[model samples]
Target: MTGKSLADYQKEYERIIFFDQPKKDILLAGLKAEMEKQFKLPTRSKEWKNENQKVIAMYRKICITRML
Candidate 1:
């Protein structure tokens, strides 16, 4: 694996670790605020439900076919 991808994953792991250990609502709110500012997104996009259902359906089909 390339060092670039490893660095990316390490960064993600550190963010997850911070979220788990802090368990602070204020900290989580700040993170969300920053993301919204940087991405110019609503942060809680209404399309998430439709998007989630599509992703779950894709996974279900894959698991069903692969297990057969």
Candidate 2:
């Protein structure tokens, strides 16, 4: 986890989600907005950062499985 880069997961997630650049940007924006709304925390806050890391880990697992 420490060594794994967000860039790797991002590329994998994009591959799995199959969205074009524009749509992908929109989707990511919506996801971020929803997370901010649900958590009621600023994105820069430690809690939000931890929560986001968890979400990214889960998504990375799903992306790995999808790739296989």
The digit string of per-residue lDDT tens for model 2 on 1-68 reads: 14334565456455646776566656655554444455443545776567687654644454344444
**Sliding window of 10 residues with minimal summed lDDT for model 2:** 1-10
- Point out where model 2 deviates above 4 Å: 1-16, 43-68
The candidate 1 region of ten consecutive residues with least summed lDDT is 1-10
Tens digits of per-residue lDDT for model 1, 1-68? 22223234334334543444345334444444443354343435657636555433433433343333
Over the full model, what C-alpha lDDT does candidate 2 score relative to the true structure? 0.53
Best by lDDT: 2
Best by the TM-score measure: 2
**What is every candidate's alpha-carbon RMSD to the true fold?**
12.1, 10.6
